[model samples]
Target chain A: MGLLSKKDAKLITDPLADNNPVTIQVLGICSALAITAELEASIVMAIAVLFVLALGNVVISLMRNIIPSKIRIIVQLIVVATLVIIVDLVLKAFAYELSKTLSVFVGLIITNCIIMGRFEAFALANTPGKAFLDGIGNAAGYGLILVIVGFFRELLGSGTLLGMQVLGDPIEKTGVYAFGYENNGFMLLAPMALITLGIIIWVQRSRNEALIEDH
Target chain B: MEKRTDKNSYTIIFATVMVIIVGSMLAFLATYLKPQIDENKRLEKQQNILYALGINDNDEKSVVFISTKDVAEKFDKYIVKQIIIQGDKVTEDDNAYLLDLKKEHAQAKDKGHQRRLPLFIGEKDGEKFYIIPMLGKGLWDAVWGYVALDKNLVVEGIFFDHKGETPGLGANINQRFFMDDFKGEHILDGTTFKGITVAKGNADPKNERKEDFKVDAIAGATITGDGLTAMIKKDLRMYMPYLQTLNK
Candidate 1:
């Protein structure tokens, strides 16, 4: 039998929707709630995750045969750590200010269950190319939710998109459209991100019939 | 051909080597960056001092002008030294204010009050200026700022910095709009110190000081604003003796 087919592709692709990493699978919720407050930071985080997930999956799948059964998990961990270090160095050098804003969140990528879970469950069992694609697909699914959540939070909360003022009405001089709220409901807080993510999950899962029954 | 290999020893040896290698690398990096980091900090402080004094000259001129030798050589011509006092008595010495309060605060672990009472005296175009340092507690962390005054001890410019205050609210203290409001505000009357004060919104910045300097506080960050006022008054009071000396 061929390793991957149309049916297999459908299975892999469907998880992006029916079994979303953040909304449905309920995995990798920590970063989803933290970095989603700002669109720029959230987008950077999404790209970082995409790189780690896809690369980790491919490497683990490739070494699956040669890796000893007893030390496979350890080997996987080393590869992920190496990749994370490289990412950290690059971030520090190129994106100094953004890196400061992200702080420890970038380093926490190593412990993200989504990366580890995908490596063990899907990557180890599948061919390298398929594993890589699955990783990208799953990461894309996660990124979609994060971007959506981040977009609304930053826009409504800060009254700006990407730190640029989209709202022209001034409250200082004329007092028209004066909400008197300076920072769009404290964009610094984490609870709002959780609430937004919960709403997204509810909306997404409510549309899927298989998940509707709550088995 | 089979051989007996001590796997335990091999693992121990590898672990030891890895630890040593990583530790030495981190130590080397720290050592390399130490001088540059210190230089960055020194240059930043020098700039802040010059900025606080409202002197915008070249870096070399700034260092030469601020050096102890130059200060002494041009003593009566430009720079004037002051002693700090509290309640009509010298609390410490004039040199106490010269020490960096940030470094002292870190070493003290928030245990002691390392108040800055030093006032910088500088001259430009035959006009004298007084540069004062103010330190206070903000909503989340420590806040420190500088106020520059003319020979008359009238406020000319101000700069405020906070550690971790909310950006838009508390951090607005760094904006020129806020600082520009301080210009021409007086802190002394003849030889008596009136001290800096916080004013209400729409209040006149030039209101005669009976007890305060009439500096306006940020609306949302009232606590921080009040904290700033208290810091300014307290720090200014410490320099009364020196101010009196300058007046004479």
Candidate 2:
């Protein structure tokens, strides 16, 4: 009952909606722009970040009591970096092609502000159980936005999802559709990712008045 | 207990222990995963080589696509000879497969140094082709490729890859449209080596000399294109002695 308590449930579900990390907190926007051009890369990035965030939160929370306040940031960084390196190594071993496609972004997860932000803002003050839930909640929030943006970007820019042809490629197959749908090349660029985020933010804020900032 | 936890000495001790643990974990993971990583790299290299030799079947009607399982067998079937050439001398070294072209090129650039260049000789449908591996610096990072030339020194096929390049601009070097343009371009001009030029959208098809040596560069990726051209010329020049001997 303690594990499934209403408060514990709120800690997990809050970030997925009203307290969304990307839309509300506006954390981890850099990776969202860089890797969302393709759905597969975006998904991999999300999973990598999720793994780092969850483990980092748990590790930090477990050590929060003994950690000297003066060196807390350094401790958090070490944990996050170690987790990132482990994720990078696992990806290289199990999913080499995707790992290559990800390249430095997986390594760059150490620099992602969301992981550090959680350690400082939540994990440091919370119990390990609550911190773990918060970590997962924030990661899901970030991952949801990434997958949504990636879905649109891949669908429009490449006429594919996860490299599978969803729409008939006009360049490859002519007369497959009544009206040829040329891929929107602009959608592949970084600017489109920003636009996609803006749209998500807009829809999210409209749906939940709580997300709007008070003037 | 509270006083002990806040002390500088305590922090140092905790930090030291944490670092040791983290360091060993990373070292262990890297060592354990090295084999799989190396295998993936080997298979990827084989696939790239087979692709450059134009043996990688993409036709859906035939076999759908060349899977990872098929790359090793296909590579062995097509690549009949592995020759190492160093300044007019050819050595039959199966270790050519293991040669790091980038490292060899760097050593060659040093004073009073000789580099052994690996050349893969492939036979497809009774016609033989020479495959030369190339390495170069792109705008951001390393760019590498394989060039396969027919007996006449005309480009048969090419496969380009990059470590880190601007996507949609420089990274398009790997695309079929860019590699396809190299086909039929002559790598030699009347016994003199004239490496393929990646012209900046100004390649003149009407001019016989330009047509023979030049291919259209990727628009908006001039640096990568230039790097590719320079890489092709520099690497191919090293193997010119072998090529010339074959001509004789």
The best candidate in terms of lDDT: 2
Give the per-prediction TM-score of chain B.
0.65, 0.89
| Sliding window of 10 residues with minimal summed lDDT for model 2 chain B | B57-66
Candidate 1 off by > 4 Å? A1-21, A25-146, A173-188, A209-215, B1-17, B43-100, B106-248
Backbone clash total for model 2 is: 0
Every prediction: chain A TM-score: 0.83, 0.91
Task: For model 1 chain A, give the 10-residue run with minimal summed lDDT.
Answer: A168-177
lDDT of 1: 0.64
User: Each candidate's lDDT (Cα)?
Assistant: 0.64, 0.82
DockQ of each: 0.09, 0.32
> After best superposition, candidate 2 residue A162: deviation in angstroms?
3.1
Error of 2 at B94 (Å): 0.9
Over the stretch B34-149, how does candidate 2's per-residue lDDT look in tens digits? Answer: 99989988888888888888877655422122578988888889999999887667798865877997788679779987788899999999999999999999988999999998
Separate clash counts for every candidate: 4, 0
RMSD of 1: 8.8
